[model samples]
Target chain A: MNKKFLLLLFSLLALLVLALTPFIGMEKIPFDTILNFDSSNIHSDIFWRIRVPRILIAFISGSALAISGMAFQAMFRNALATPFTLGVSSGAAFGAALYVKIGFIFSLLGISGQTLFAFAGALVSIMLVYILSKVKKGFPVGTMLLAGVAINFFFSSFILFIQFISDFTNSFRIIRWLMGGFEVIGYSDIYNVIPFIIIGTIIIILLSTELNLLTLGEDVAVSRGVSLSKVKNILFFATSLMVSGVISVVGPIGFVGMMVPHISRLIIGADHRYLVLLNIIFGGAFLVLCDTLSRILIAPAEIPVGVITALLGGPFFIWLLIKSSNNNSI
Target chain B: MSKILFNIENLSFSISKKEILKSLSLKIYEGDYLSIIGPNGGGKTTLIKCLIKIYQSPVNKIFFKEQPIEKIPQKKLASQISYVPQINETNFPFTAKEFLMLARYPHLSRFSSVTAADTKAVASAFDITNTTNLANRFMNTLSGGEKQMIFIAAAFAQGGEVILLDEPATFLDPKHEHNVYQILKTIHQETNKTIVTVTHNINSAILNSNRIALIKNGKLDFYGNSVDITKNNILEKAYNKKFTFIKHPASEKSIIVPEVV
Candidate 1:
């Protein structure tokens, strides 16, 4: 734990350095001049409009996804499991598509419509999975995951259907939505997602011990004074809320939840406290790095943030399978 | 006087909804060592489950002495009587200490960290079961006998008044089986804790238990002292086979095994 804390501290410091690297390029905006009184106004615009939101988004989304991943992993007791394992991403995507079809309903409502619809969709999907399982005293794993797969497929297919029928303008917008890019990120996204992310992460930290007990299986968990249903309800609700917030704003940016927790578990053991925190830090760093690389890899034409995570995370997941088979302690 | 700690008014079993127990009743007094010997699927486990209130049967009307089974909270019930089920495939790599800590859960509140008392139980449980060396080892890494000792250690950690063991020696080696019986006997003698062991090992029941209640087709066929089970007619009726009681090789103790139909 001490070593992990040190590693996290080191990573945060490294992120600070990378965050500054953006200020020193061909467009070389001096650090202190970022908000100076005399300037071409490029420094303030770059810092406030682009760089800061991008960095903050990186930090918030990274931690939120990682913590949500840890919660899902512990709840399911499966290394491959993530928050979206129960169809949160697909459900949120479907919600966003529904919003697009209705043409800016938020202009009248004057609210962040994506976040609201995403949360509602995610919550409904979670409930749908639980309901579809034919729940007995408690939810069964095989039934729950199967329902998730079915729901995910249904929503994903609906998203594809929307893409197929919509006009070129709407289709291009849908393409960007699906392939997650963060170029136009602003303060509003941060304002919308931060509270849900912070509260959910803290609650998860407090519930870490309960999750550790839950790993011993339901009989042991229930015997240990944890109301099994309450733990499940809290975890599901928190993860859904956090993931829905992120997915609604950023679109379904897959793999942060899937790979980050696994890597964190490797660094720390099955202890959820360190696992959850480390995942957040590492996840944020990884995504921010990927998003930065995507911006520069094509220079003027930024790549989709999701592509880098997909390409890298998919192979890493496969390697985990191979490694875990050899090292069964995983 | 031995206080009646548990009473089973009726707990039956059936296959495909066919009735097995017909309003049967029994009493369990503290400091008593009772053995339940019966045929396969004779509702011994079912009756035990009803007493624990795992199933919602008409037999759930049974009580733990003065209070109804449902009335006593699960944690409180767990404190009074600990149940150690038969060994099965434990696929996960849970440690011995972690397994014992589960017993202390009923004694704890939410967010209440495990105290020195829990550590003491874990240490003593290790000492009692002689799993002190296997403390840090995963359950999957241990031998069957070692694992059985770990389960016994878990039950001991519960600090319950009554210990219910179902075929405890089912997967254990002979030496380990003897150790298990000796452990239970020591617990009964030292703590005066009530023991309810269900087993197919009739000789083990006769040797370790104070009394034997024979069951057939989910009903109590015979109930009496260990000495009373030595008769040919009782053995024949209980086992549905002819048997002879021969003195143990080195001791005055006797064993009754089936001879003929």
Candidate 2:
């Protein structure tokens, strides 16, 4: 089949899945109430206020994580690298834990204090990784990966320390928040995250050619007329914002970033020009499917969406490892 | 009599307190095909890197077209010179055409796709390098000789005035080694481009280049025409060995026969 045609088919399938997901929940929403288009219809309230926002949040977060993952992988030249590898999620978890421990029961402009602190923590860790990655020469991939793992462990220990000090209720809340899920009530949360997703995606897609050059290595990228520092700086800032933005709202969903890009690379090629858009579609659909399954698997008892993702992604990751080792592809 | 294309004066470089290039100076003119030959760890590759500013030479030391290299933007510099490293390996699978298309990067706009002119240049490069059949083949799957051909084709597609290569024929059989140099020789004879290559294969360098520069311990041990390079015991001093110089059987050119002990 023609590659473009295959892409179009996948895109339409994704759209269909996105459109059909809101109707298949635990409680039966009346079809007429959905079609009624009334201001106070209970069914319409469920559709718009509850289901649509949840679907939108899942799609947005999934797409953001996947795209950021692809960029991080290419930049670091590591197949296993993800947006959260540099302790972004752990930093956010630490911040959220600290917020809970401090007894701050405040909300600013509908944004919780935990979300703000989590984003701040993510930014700090990202800066540290960025600085450590820079040697006298340009960014070294090995050092970046090591520094990321180091920061990740460092922040994780602090998070454990925070949890140890917090009281039961605060600790419970913090733990629940860390197990990411999509329980967004209305359109406001979706609206808040959509802008960051759009801007970050656009900036990254525009530099897709440069990203392709980077896959050839840094010296080749420089010889090909790519401004290494400029491209790296932009990508770093963009991926940082996207990861921080989504994790703050969704509370650090795991493996969606790594799994989605690798799967998309299998279906599509490694050309970032095409890979970026395909990843967005596949990632969004993958999360929506996982989110839907999480809600419906045991009705009235919700599994954290993070658990579903890891459960699905873990096997696939193992299969990838075995396949690569078998074929000596890595 | 031609104007100088590249001028180096008092160039020096160091990595982690160890100097790799000393205050070496040389002048290369327009349309000069120069090959640099040296033993291992003699700063031959580092000299090429310094010439291309990959090692970040000092201010006002290295000049291209009589202008300080630091003053030129990366795109403009890439437009003037192209580099082919000794080992070119990409972890991801890119087709030969796709790999060559990157050569046109310095010439393309930020948002535009590959244009007709770019395609034409790539096609011409394939024809010139005899790599038309390898266009759709994955670069990683290719043999060393095929990959070297594609690399040279890509560098040609870069359309730069100076094409710098480091060990263009490394890791290849004798037939492919000669074939690689033959293709480079054709490019030099057919165009006004200045070609600079650093290689350990002294016979191949002598067969192709117009001028030769022999480096030893980060200094220029010898710099002259290839015909004049065979007279001194420079190779023996540079490599700490004995060499037997003989005339080529067919062309009567100077060729070195290493007297292996």
Candidate 3:
């Protein structure tokens, strides 16, 4: 098959899955809810207020994580590099844990204190990493990774400390959120995030040319006229914003960001223009399917979507390692 | 009668008190084929990096066509001088055509897509480097020599008068090494490009470059026409070892051979 045609077919299939996901849930949203809207439209209420927003959030947040993952992988030139590799997710988790443990009653713009704190934590961790990298003459990748690992350890210990002191209910809440969930969200909750995700993803797509050159190496990219520092800084902030926004709301979903980009690369190759778009489509569908499975697997008892992804993603990751080791293509 | 294209004057670079380049000065003409050769860790690669402004130089020290190099925007400078990096493996598997298209970046605007003329340039670059068949192949799947040729083709697509190459044939077999040099020679003669390459391959440099720049201890110990290189004992000084030159049977270029005990 032609590569373009194959990509299109895959995208359509993913879209079909995404579209069909809302109707297959526990309540079985009436298929005619879209075409009929009377005053006492219970089906319309379920479809519009709950199912639609849940799927939209799932698709948006999933794509956000995946797109950011692809960008970070190129930035660090490491396959394992994800948006969370630099401790962004850990930092957010710590903040959310702190908020829950402290029982913070404050809310900004009807947004919970936990979400606000999570965003701040993610940004602060990235800022710390940025500052650490600036101590060197060039922003060396190895140094940044080491610093990120250090910060990740630091935040994880703090989160554990918070968990130790919290009451049983608060600690349980914190643990469940950390495990990741896509629930109880409406369009108003994500209205602001939509703009940031759209803008960030679009900007990354436009700079796909530079992203392609960067995979060759920093020096090669610079020699090709890419302002290395400018591109790096822009991508860092954009990726941080996107990742932080999703983690703040959806609570740090894992595996989708790291695994989806690699899967897309294996399927479509590593050109970011195509990779980014395909990831948005395919990655969105991937999490919707996972979320659907999470809801339906236990039937009225929901497992965290994050756990479902890990359960599936773990074997895929191991297979990738074995295949690469056997053939050494990676 | 070629005009000076690059002028380096009293330039120096250091990292944490460790000097990589001293107060070295040299003039490169518009269409000169210059080779920079030195022993390992003698700053040959560093000099190439400095020339391309990867290591920032003083405002007036490095001039491009009599204008301060720092004044040129990165995009404009790239269009004037493209670089071919040493053959290295890439984990990302971009096709050769997609990889080559990145060379057209400096000519492109932020939001615009690649156009028909850009495709023509890429096609012509493939023709020059004899890499048309490899266009659709994944970059990581190609052999080292093939990858090197594709990079050179990318440089040609960059539309630069000056092409800086860093060890273009370091890890290739003899046949591929000769093939790479032949492609470079054609680019130099036919396209009228100023070629400056850093190489440990003394014979290849001597055969392909019109002039040689010998670097030692972060300074240029010799810079002259290739024919004039044999008139001095600079090679021994540059390497801190004894050397002798032999004539190539066909090209008649001097080949440097080390004295082994």
Candidate 4:
């Protein structure tokens, strides 16, 4: 099949999924009520206030994670690299857990205390990774990855300790947050995450050419005029900011970041120019569909979207590994 | 006398407190085909890297076109100089054409699409290297020699006057090695491009290059015309081993063979 044709077909399917997913849930809101724009109607109220905002957040967060994952994979030149590979998600989860444990109730700058703490945690992890990697002369990729893994483990253990000491309710809240979900009710969550996604996507798209050269090797990228340190710093900062923002709002959703980009690459090839756009659409639709399934899977008792993604992602990942090993193309 | 394209003045480099390139100084003139040859662990690769600014040389140590190379922005420097790194296996699946297109990075502005000039440069690169058939093929799928040619084509597509290659023909069969050198020779003669290649093949170095720089133990052992290389036992000194010099039957150029004990 033609790659462009596949891209177009996948994009159209994604658009259709995005358009249809909001209407799918435990209680189906009719398309007519959604189109009527009658906020007073109960069905319309559910469609406009509940489903729309949830889908919007889901789409935005999904795309953010996917693109960030794609960029990290390229920067590290490793297929398994994800947005959370550098511990941003773990750090954010630790912050949210700390907020639950300490019983913080206040909001700052119109942002919830939990969100603020999570973002702060992400910044700290980024700083730690940066400092650790900088100890080497060249800020080697392997060093950065190892540093991130160490930080991830450190924060993860702290979260577990916090959970161990907390009351049952607080422990449950932290556990739920760790599982990840879209329990959003209004437009506020959408407002919180859109800026990071837009800005980070722009930065990544602009550097798509550099990312292409980078996948070849550092020596190749530098010889071709990429400012290695400068590009790496900017990409790292942008991806961290985007991942931190999304994870802060929606908790730490796994698999989308690592999985979507590879699926996109398999579909569209590894050109970041097209891969970025495809990952955005495919990833967004994928999560929205998964989130909708989370709503309808058990009906009224929502399974965390994270659970659904993992359930699907683990099998898909295994299959991908097998397929790629057969062809020896990752 | 031709203009000097690169001037290295007392350049030294170190990593982890271990010196790799000692105070090295040499002049590379425009249109010159200079081959750097030495034993393993010598600073041959390091010298090529410094010239391409992969390793930052100290200020006033290296100059390109009479301007301090450190002062040139990386993009501009890349536009003036291109490098073909030692070929290695890559897992990336970028098509050969797409791979060639990335060579246009120095010439492209952020957010701008590839222009007609960029396309023409890439097409001409394929023509010159005679690897257009490999354009649509995935990079990793190509044979080692084919990949080497594509890399050279990428260097050509970069549109730089000077090309630096580190071991352009290593790990290849004899035919591919000859093909690699043949393409380099054509690029040099037809385009008048300045080429600095690092190789362990002393015979090919003497035959293909006008000048040779012999580096050993992070220092320059000799810098002179290729024909003068055999006169002072420089090969023997650089390798710390004995060699027998012989004239090539075809070109009558001086070549050397290691004398086995």
Candidate 5:
């Protein structure tokens, strides 16, 4: 198949999915009712107020995770890397859990305390990963990955400990947040996540060439005149900001990050120039589809979107592992 | 005498408090086909890295085109000198053309698209290295010889005046190894670009390079004409092994033969 044609077809398909998915769910919102602007119309209210914002949040969060995952994989030159690989999501979850335990109700500058704490926790985790990786001589990728996994375990245990000590109501709230969903009411979540996503996407696109070179090898990249440290720092900071922003809003959604980029790369080769954009479009559509399934699976009582992605993603991940081992390349 | 392209003044490099290159001073003249030869652990690769600023020497120690190496921006330095790294397995499945295009990084800005000149350079690189047929093939799928040719082609596409190759024929059959050297010789002769190669193939290095620098224990054991290598027991002293000199069948130049243990 022609690569450009394939890209265009997939892009159009993704757009179609994004366009059609907002009409699905427990509420039957007809096409005509979507055109009705009257506030009194319950169907219009549900379409505009509930479904649209939820889909937008899902699309944005998925796109952010997918692109960040793509960047991480290229940066580490490893296929298994994801947005949450460095425990940024776990760190943010811990922050939200701690906030719930403290019972903080204050909002700062129109942002909730939980979001702020989660962002802070994400930054803290990134800093710790950086410091830990620096303990080695040259910030080698193996050391960085091991450091990230260690930090991931460390934060996870802390989250578990916090959950253990909390009251039943708070414990339940923490568990619900950890499950990861898009139960957003309006465009507020959109506003909170859009800036980070936009900034991160732009940064990744700009450095797409460097990302391509880095994937070959660090020596090759440096020999080709890439400033390794500068590029790596920028990539880490951008991915952290983007991941933290989305995780703060939607809790720690998993598998979208790991799965979407891999799927995109499989369809399009590892040329990051096209891969990054494909990840955004396909990843967004994919999560919207998953979130729609979550909403309609049991009609009124919805399964968390995270559970659906994991259920699908786990098998896909194992299949990928097996395939990679067979070919000795991923 | 040709202008000096690179000048090293008492450059010393260390890693983890252990010195790897000890106060090495040398000058590389423009249009010089210089080969660096040494036994294992003799810092040949490290010297190439330092020349490209992959390993920074002490301040004011290494100079490129009379400017301090550290002061030169990496992109500018890259445009001036290109490197062909030792062969390693590439995991990514970049097509040969896509892989070669990455060599244009030093000449391109972030927003600049591929220009006509870039395309011409890449096409000419393929033409010169005779790898135009492999341009569409995935890099990982190519054999060692083909991959080495592609690496050389990438260096040509980079359009640097100087090409530094680290053991370009390390893991190839004799036919492929001879092909690599032939292409490099044609490139050096036709373009008059300075070529610095680090090679363990002592015979080929002596035959091809105009000058030879034999390093031993992080120091310059000998630096002189390639033919002069057979004089003064240089090979025996550097490798700590006895060698018998023999004349090449084609060119009648002196070549070394290792004595049986």
Candidate 6:
């Protein structure tokens, strides 16, 4: 608990840093300026409109991807399982892309159309994994992951197909979205996403004990006062929702989820009750640092936050995998 | 004089299209040290798995204390029955003590802090399993027998009404195997929790259990008191072998193992 507390405190300190990033760049941006400066000018516009929303979006999306990835990885007992691992990213992206191309058609539904459609897309892709996995009793981790991979491929091809035919005007936007970025974020994105993130994350945190029991093995979990079908179903959909909600707005960010949980597990045991909280805190800091590097290290032309995560996360995942295999006990 | 803790009636399970268990029915009463033994692919482990609700696939309509297993939430079921699976490959290298701490999981909610009572159970498990000194030792570092002891201790720490061991002694040395039986016997006697172990070690099963059931080809061949099984005729009939109920050649004590071919 002390270790977790320290991790949390450090994470809270990092969040403080993230909150300060817009004011800390090469330009003499100040916290006072953010509050007192007029919103009319280019500098103010860049800070309040573009940067604030983008940072919040990155924070929400990073937490969402990492937390959901932790849930998926724990449930599947697969380090490779991530927000994008099971094709949820591709599924949601495809749906959103289709909506972007056919915006005029969905404009018939009034406001919140594309985001809603994107959410639906993310939900549907997981639904595909669920349907495939649901066939033989409770969802086995192996089957769920395999289904996720297959769905990911299907959606990837679909995304490619959409990209291939998209006209000159929309091509650049589509390409940018595919590469993944944290720019041009809007307040609407925050309002649309923050509520779901809060609700979903709370439910998961509340059920952390069940998640811990699950780490012991399914039978052990069931025997220990957990209902396998109900909990797994709720957890699966809830996790998917968290990831979908974030990805629908800012696209997918990688590695924050995939890499952080294992490190926490390495620190603590496979106890989800502790792991979930630790992952959220550490994951937030880990992503904030990555995003900060993206903004400053590259200067005015910011690199996609996802790139930094992948570079760090991929190698870390291999090391953890080797460590887990070497020990050979879950 | 005993109450039925678990009742399985017409329970069926399948993997893909093939039926793993078919119309199997059995009733396990309280204080029954039951061992379900059979050959490979004989559904011994499968039956125990189903009873613990860890079958290859799910078993349909399992009953716990006359209530449907489906209706009983896992947390409550865990408070009543704890299962120790045959050791499989794992990635977490928990200490022997940490492994037993997992038994406290059922009694714990995600937000619930680990109480002293939970630690007490873990400590008790360590003491009973004779692995107290190995508390800080990594599970991966333990020898096969020591690891098995730690695993049993983990299951016992759950503090449930029943303990299910699925071949808990598999891959153990002779000394460790004997120790496992002794540990189970001590736990059953001291705690009065029902013990169900699945194994091929018929001798220990005979010695430690109050009753033994033969599970073969996904069916229960026979179920009776361990004392009754000492009868050569019944033993030979159920096992399809020749045997003599005699004392051990070296120890000069009652034993059931060596059979004539």
- Cα lDDT tens digits, model 4, A263-299, are 7887888888889989888888888989988988788
Taking the tens digit of each residue's C-alpha lDDT, what string does model 5 give over B46-133?
8899888777678899899999998998899999899998987765569899988999999998888999999999999999999999
Q: How many backbone clashes does candidate 3 have?
A: 0
lDDT of 2 at B12: 81
Candidate 1 docking classification: acceptable
Alpha carbon deviation, residue A59, candidate 4 (Å): 0.9
Candidate 1 local lDDT, A155-225, one digit each (tens)? 98888888788878887887798788676545877887777788888788888877876776655454434
Model 6 agreement with the true structure over A1-330: per-residue lDDT tens digits: 466676667677767867777675656665556665576765777788877777767767766776787777766666766667678787878877887677564432332565666677888887776677667665655466677778888988887788778886666677677656676555876887777688779878887766766666666666666777788788877876777677666666666777777677777666676677777766766666677788888787877777877788778767766765544333
Please give the range of 10 consecutive residues that has the lowest summed lDDT in model 1 chain A. Answer: A133-142
lDDT (10s digit) by residue, model 5, range A102-136: 89687777767777788788878877876665565
Q: Predicted candidate 6: interface RMSD? A: 2.9
Question: Against the hidden reference, what TM-scores do the models get?
Answer: 0.83, 0.94, 0.92, 0.94, 0.95, 0.88
Chain A TM-score from candidate 5: 0.92
Give per-residue CA lDDT, model 2, range B8-109, as digits (tens).
887787777888778888898889899998878878888787776666788999999889998888888888789988865544468899999988999998
lDDT of 2 at A148: 74
Give, for candidate 2 chain A, the lowest lDDT window spanning 10 residues: A321-330
Q: How well docked is model 3, in DockQ terms?
A: 0.59
How far is A155's C-alpha from truth in model 4 (Å)? 0.6
Q: What is the lDDT of residue B80 in candidate 2?
A: 79
Report the C-alpha displacement of residue B186, candidate 3, in angstroms. 1.4
Distance from true position, residue A171, model 6, in Å? 2.4
Docking class of 5: medium
Please state the error at residue A168 of candidate 3 in Å. Answer: 4.7
**Candidate scoring better on DockQ of 3 and 4:** 4
Go through the candidates in order and give each one's C-alpha lDDT.
0.74, 0.82, 0.81, 0.86, 0.86, 0.73
* Candidates sorted on lDDT, descending: 5, 4, 2, 3, 1, 6
